[model samples]
Target: SNRFSYSMNLKGASMTIDTACSSSLVCTHVSKLHLRYKDNEIMPASVVNGLNLMLFPGPFVGCCAAGMLSHEGRCFTFNSTADGYARGELCGALLFKAKQFNPADGGLCCLAGSQTNQDGRSASLTAPNGPAQEKCIAAVLKEVGLTPTEVDCIECHGTGTSLGDP
Candidate 1:
């Protein structure tokens, strides 16, 4: 209601997604699709935002019980001593416009494409699915007309869990 009231002059669609770790990425993907289909006539810009507020005691106790909280209180993302993740709060937003809007202005970076999927029928709801993850990567690469070797960097959900870091 707050965001809609503030942006009453702006005419476009707005939505919120709660996909756990991949929420922001999914939002960007949806925005990209909107720009590709709608163009500037219907929608001029897309704003993707993510806010993570860690509530004390409640989430902390849950994570602890689930053995997801790091004993040393450190996130060793790709380290030998990787055990569990250290919780942290984060808030960020990004604005996106179609490349045709301003051809000369390349902006900060270009997003070729994005794809997301769930680990269906996994061992557990929270367990990571290696094959499903690989399929998602392959799908994204195929969508963007690029090979795995051509891509440079990828931001992944590295929660520091030993079993989850595949």
Candidate 2:
């Protein structure tokens, strides 16, 4: 993060978040909040990055032991026969800016809002609570003064497991 900031000449606050599967989304959520919380003079923009790399076999072995790796070696999310999710690596970043700073080209797209929630009573660590997830989405839409129909897209965090996929 520091290296990227140095290269880009960004001096605002920067940090890393490691919440496993939801790390990227969590980073995005935080960035959205930061863009909204601070004034233009302080921080009118923010950058969020997430990387999942398996440089070693420790995590692979651990997930295998915990039966978190799919036997078919593929992710069958939302499927009834899903055993687990397929593990992989990804590196991505997103730039978030305040509405007032929108470029003349209109930029890529606008991030209306973001929200995070946890399922304390989930069946397992990787399991997703449908109700909790629904509540979180509802809250975000309501906070943004929009209904379900107005939503253009929803990037979700899926685990491939039967309970986790939903």
Q: Which tens-of-lDDT digit does each residue in 1-166 have in candidate 2?
A: 7888899999888888888777888888888887788776788778888888889999999989988888999988777777888888888777777765455856877777789988887777766667988899899988889989987777765677766654
Q: Residue 106 of candidate 2: its Cα lDDT?
A: 67
Best by TM-score: 2
* TM-score against native, each model: 0.87, 0.87
Q: Give the C-alpha lDDT of model 1.
A: 0.81
Per-residue lDDT for 34-58 in model 1, tens only? 9888867778777788888876579
- What are the C-alpha RMSDs, in order, of all predicted structures? 2.4, 2.1
Model 2 steric clash pairs: none
Clashing pairs in 1: none
User: Pairing residues by index, what is the TM-score of model 1?
Assistant: 0.87
What local lDDT does model 2 show for residue 33? Answer: 81
Q: Looking at model 2, report the run of 10 residues with the lowest lDDT sum.
A: 157-166
Which regions of candidate 2 are displaced past 4 Å? 100-103, 121-124
